[model samples]
Target: MSQHARLPLTLDQLWQFSLQYYSAREIKEACLHLQNHFHGNVNLLLMLKWLDEAKLTFAPQDWSKITQSLGNIESLLRDYRELRRKLKVHVSDSLYKETLHFELQLEKQQQTALVNCINSLTLTDCEHPHLVEQYCLQLGAERLVRIFIQPVSSQSHNL
Candidate 1:
């Protein structure tokens, strides 16, 4: 059986800590645990035991349940990307409008300073890189897929 629960922290406690300080180290620790035990060469019997105990604060329930299918971790990545693709197609139109509305609202500012401020907003400006990475990792290509596959008749460059 692979050692998964070696981390001293519980997922709920870890989540609270993450919210408090926006720390990635603790979250990374839990991710490492998942990667080591669940993503890597998982031992079914032990993995199940860990799964029952884990309550999966970070990963989705289905992901944890997929231990039996995890012959190769890369397979999960492929599946993740494919799922992202499908989500993109499904939600593209709505997101396209949302993005446009967001930008337009930002643009509508009468003051040049506000427009500049909005334009200056960048990923680097965020206080939490790990949160961004985790979100992107979760979101994958869904946003891109949606934007790319949006109805051709819709406005393109505005988004």
Candidate 2:
């Protein structure tokens, strides 16, 4: 435990944080690149960003549990995402939008699961910096890490 205690995190906070960052074009591009190129889970990456921003830290086993909790939802999300992508060219604009909306709903479900998982975990105030960068690097997302580490002023232009 750390001296600087904060309120417990919530789904809305994590979702809002993710939406704020993901709204930036450069951040979206970086996240998509990591997802398509490195097989990164976008939700997990966002969760990491949320955790970092909240100054929270968790153990390796806690991470394992989090991932385990998301296993089924991850599969469904992947399937829906793939379907949405494939339908982009074949479906009517309205139909495509519907598919996209459904995919977003699935993403929200994943985020809810993540918030629950984190709530069940033992988290401490951050003892180290650049936790998000380190995790991205471990995933071999060096370029994407820069997007996260850069100042908000720099990213603001891309919003």
Candidate 2 lDDT over 1-159, as tens digits, reads 742245456777777778888998988998888888887888888878766766677876676787787889888887878888887999899999898888888888988888888777777777554657876887888877878866444332221
Candidate 2 versus the native: TM-score? 0.87
Tell me the TM-score of each prediction against the true structure: 0.19, 0.87
Model 1 lDDT tens row, 56-124: 222334333343243343454445435555666567788756655553333222122222222222211
In the order shown, the candidates' Cα RMSDs to the true structure are 20.8, 3.5
Candidate 1 residues lying further than 4 Å off, grouped into runs, are: 1-7, 17-74, 92-159
Give, for candidate 1, the lowest lDDT window spanning 10 residues: 150-159
Q: For each candidate, how many residue pairs have backbone atoms clashing (under 3 Å)?
A: 0, 0
State the C-alpha lDDT per candidate.
0.32, 0.76
Misplaced by over 4 Å in model 2 are 2-5, 151-159
